[model samples]
Target: MGAQHDKMEVGDLKQEANRASPVNIIVSPDGMMYDYLNLPGRVIINEEVGASGESLSTRKPVKIEKLYEYVSALRSNSFKFLLREYEELCEISPQCPQTVGLSEINQSKNRYGNIVPFDHSRVRLKPMMGKESDYINANFIPGYKNARAYIASQAPLPMTVNDHWRMIWQQRICIIVMITGLVERGRRKCELYWPKPGFPIKYGLVEVTNIKEEVRLDYLVRILRVKIGREKSPKSRHPILIHCSAGVGRTGTYVAIDRLIQEIQAKHRNVDIFNTVYDIRKSRSMMVQTVRQYMFIYDFHLDAWQIEGDPEGFKNRKMVERQKELDSKYKELTSKDDLMVEQKATYDLYELFLMAACCCCPFLFDKN
Candidate 1:
């Protein structure tokens, strides 16, 4: 009776193990990978095909050898799941002290009441003679090595223009990367804190002179007396100030890209973006606010890899087309849909990614 019971127990354990097994992955004939997620609907093979109606090879070029692993990780079935996991972690993570930012004296300085910097990471400006408070709605977001590498701040309000310039002057900030315009969708997103080109504006004791303005297809560059560079110079030692409307979403995205660029340049591989954004969120709440922004980091990193791989500028026609496609995708993500219905949109993207993962190399997704 004991021997029979042991055999039955072993059989039950095997059944349980089978139930816990991962989904079956298969490789398509066209070199694409696919993950059979066992969804009720039929598998819709949405892929980019050539003129001959054959699926284009999804393999990475030898030039981007280092990115092979990274690319595989992005295309894995688990990638989206990991993104979702990290996002949930961000919600439940231990928060730093925000008492100073929430205090009555500093309440009016914040652009959005809820989006305040933690006391430990907040930037402190020199207290002016008349103004007793040395507070700014900004936090010191760390980079690869520097703890105070970047100052993530909210867009300046009309009332806080002087405080903005004061923080800039006190920090000796060289570059100001403004990610939003003065207005968006008939709403005032940020205040014009700088003077017009060829004009000098004095905010508090600091004078900002706009020397030149260069307009491009998508963005405009303004040459200001406050120089922009990350050299070892004393003037450039201060953290580079980056701000958007609320300062978390776009600022965090840009900061992540900056950190990844540095990492890729130094090592060319082993880049962990999940952990990168995780650390950023630890410093400030909702840094990379949405999954769309998180996906944009992947897109930007892929583009960077391509550009870096082919230093000779000998990209094929397919590469150029891919670049254009990424650019179009960037524009779409920046639209109002990203702000509204983001949860739905992100899940929709996850579904598409899972489909693509089914068509990719299974070895890349292998845990071993």
Candidate 2:
């Protein structure tokens, strides 16, 4: 009875913590649930559902009403695409790059150390002193053709917290997108890297002031303005560093959404989410980690993007226009949070738990 009572008490607390705020209000699609990623709520699928594949003969844009259908097609076609992109893509080994003073496998987040960042796009932190390989296990991923991409990294351990801030300061980051907590299930996911709101915190050469902090049901978005004195400022741009427990599932998922929205703003509206994931994995070995995470990209993209075409000269202009009016969003309205997605969802009408190949293949059924 004690354990049972404890469970009930915990459930009640989650409900209270997740109670809807004005920020939680959202609209979703029919037969779909509310925004699970951005909104605070839960939906459990009682049973699995499937959809018959439709012939997709052309790359021409589909009607906005058929956005979900388009997503299904892209999903069904993902496996074959993976097979084709296998050589230059896919995870091989979990090994971190060897640096001075660190053990061959030290500071690695996982047993095999399989998901290391690529050399070409790795973020090199400014060393504290002397001679030690300033490695913190982070990757510098390039965004789509035009959008400024982010640094996807694992949660900072207690020791590496200083190096993490050093990287942020060296890079002149404008936004910090943290997807996991300091701890989860009695294990440490990330350290307390920043000061609480209304307090000034200094990490290494970087001085951080929390501009604003907004709590979301699915994640926490903090607007931060960081300054690094006596260092070269490349450009005062919005460079985001997204981190989570493992730094694959949630980190990759958020970056994918932001990049896709950038493409949408550029009028390249018909998005191939699979290709985007493939491109991201090129920089970080095991990005968009799980089958569930891949499906999440679909949910977020469908919810955020509309099929309607913007007028000529509308490149990335929607953001500037929406910022003045979108007060509920807190930060700039240029993120995935502003889009309309189903606020509640349970089981995937499409398969979710299967491996990448199986889940991405065609799901055949009566289409007539």
Q: Highest lDDT: which candidate?
A: 1
Clashing residue pairs, backbone N/CA/C < 3 A, model 1 = 32-359, 33-358, 33-359, 33-360, 34-358, 34-359, 34-360, 35-358
Q: Candidate 2's residue-wise lDDT over 178-247, tens digit each?
A: 6665655455667888776778677766666666766434434565556666443344554577777667
Model 2 stretches with alpha carbons more than 4 Å out: 1-66, 72-112, 146-148, 210-235, 306-368
Q: lDDT of all the models against the reference?
A: 0.58, 0.48
The residue-level lDDT of candidate 1 at 267 comes to: 52
Put down candidate 1 lDDT per residue, 106-160, tens digits, no spaces: 8988888778998888888877657557788999999887888889999999989
Residue-level error in angstroms, candidate 1, position 128: 2.6
Q: Give the Å shift of residue 6 in candidate 2.
A: 27
Segments of candidate 1 deviating more than 4 angstroms:
1-89, 226-235, 310-320, 327-368
lDDT of 1 at 162: 85
